[model samples]
Target: MPTIIFVQQDGSEQRVHADVGQSVMQVAVNNQVPGILGDCGGSCSCATCHGYVEKDWAAHMPAAESYENDMLTCAMDVTDASRLTCQIIVTPELDGLVVRLPALQT
Candidate 1:
């Protein structure tokens, strides 16, 4: 399992262990981590699971596909590092991944 650190808007951190193959949103929701609503339940339809991948770890993630990139257009405070957690699948290479939550979710 890989450990993911979710940083909230207030700078609070929730560290949770995520099994390989699970979406980051799934792990956050399973662990009750604040700031990740997962409103679409891992589907790419909603932008509610938005977060910013830490700079160093961003490159470790696969580039967002067309649908996910389109969905992110509806998210608030979008950034170069913004990504929908549901679009991020956990892998051994993503161990210690850190994602920062936006001030508010769309």
Candidate 2:
């Protein structure tokens, strides 16, 4: 399992153990992490699972697919590091990945 860290807008952090092959949003939802609301159930249709990947760990993640990028356009507070957590699948190489929740989700 890979351990992912989710930092809330208030600076609170929740560390979760994600099973390999599960989506980051799934891990957050499963663990009851407060900031992520995966309204679309990992689908790219909703941007509710939006989050920002930590800069250092960003290099290790795969680029967002076209559909995911399209969905992100609907998210609030978008940034270069912004990503939809449902599109990020957990892998062994991604252990200790860190992501930060935006102040609000659209």
lDDT of each: 0.92, 0.92
Query: Deviation in angstroms for 21 in model 2?
Result: 0.3
Winning model by lDDT = 1
What does candidate 2's lDDT look like per residue over 1-106, in tens digits? 7899999988988988989999999999999988789988987788999999999988898998888899999999899999999999999999999999999887
Instruction: Report the error of model 1 at residue 12, Å.
Output: 1.4
Error of 1 at 98 (Å): 0.4
The segments of candidate 1 whose C-alpha lies over 4 angstroms from its true place after superposition are none
Model 2 poorest 10 in a row by lDDT: 35-44
Please, what's the RMSD in Å of model 2? 0.7
TM accuracy, model 2: 0.96
Clashing pairs in 1: none
Instruction: Give the clashing pairs for model 2.
Output: none
Which segments of model 2 are wrong by more than 4 Å? Answer: none
